[model samples]
Target: MPAILDDFPVLTPVTDEDLALAVQAVRVHAPEDWPHGTLCRSERVPYPCRLARWGGVTLAAAGLTDDQVSALVGTDA
Candidate 1:
């Protein structure tokens, strides 16, 4: 089971573009060779990042609070 589980409200929902961009951003910016805290797992790089940014935006669009959205996936979104 995945330890990361956060419920995202259907308010804004996730668009195909958003998902795609998110994946790409994570892939490109966060190289596997980077250290654990080297922007891999942190809010230093604009939180969830482009993909994560979409998530936070969607959640916010759903009427969630900033903290709530950030807390949803149990990750810093």
Candidate 2:
């Protein structure tokens, strides 16, 4: 299992288009308050839904810090 983990979620080299798409995803999928719990604003799923997570990963791959990504998307989620 540990060995398999080493190769999981392969990350390709970040590209300008990838970074732009990631930022857009994060912006569109920002979290929203809910009675049950925080949820994804666009998809209405749990906070930090798959698209948000993907955006974060892509941003990180593009050498962006958490703060930078948050600022780029104008949200902390």
Candidate 3:
């Protein structure tokens, strides 16, 4: 018996192309007032726009360094 259970893997391998597609989906589905709109007005960032957030999580889960995700998302520092 272990002190902590591994449970299940929530993160899976993802490719750069996948991330790109997610980003595109976000952009395509973003509302006119997105990025600044209230959550009430929109239900969880709408359809594809939610992909951006999902992409970030997936990128991180795929073992990508923060810098890598940022670079892919054009937020490199």
Best-matching candidate per TM-score = 2
Clash pairs for candidate 1:
6-72, 22-51
Writing each residue's lDDT as its tens digit, candidate 2 over 1-77 gives: 77753422416798888889899988999889999999999999888887788888888988999889978988664
- Candidate 1 residue lDDT tens string, 1-77: 44344433333366666544444444443312244434434445533444454454554554667566445444354
Better of 2 and 3 by TM-score: 2
Best by lDDT: 2
True-structure RMSD for candidate 1 = 12.1
Clashes of 1: 2
Worst 10 residues of 2 by lDDT: 2-11
Checking candidate 3 for backbone clashes, the offending pairs are none
| lDDT against the true structure, each candidate | 0.46, 0.83, 0.51
Write candidate 3's Cα lDDT for 7-66 as tens digits: 322344566676666555434434344575533223454443344456556656667777
Query: Please, what is the TM-score per model?
Result: 0.36, 0.80, 0.41
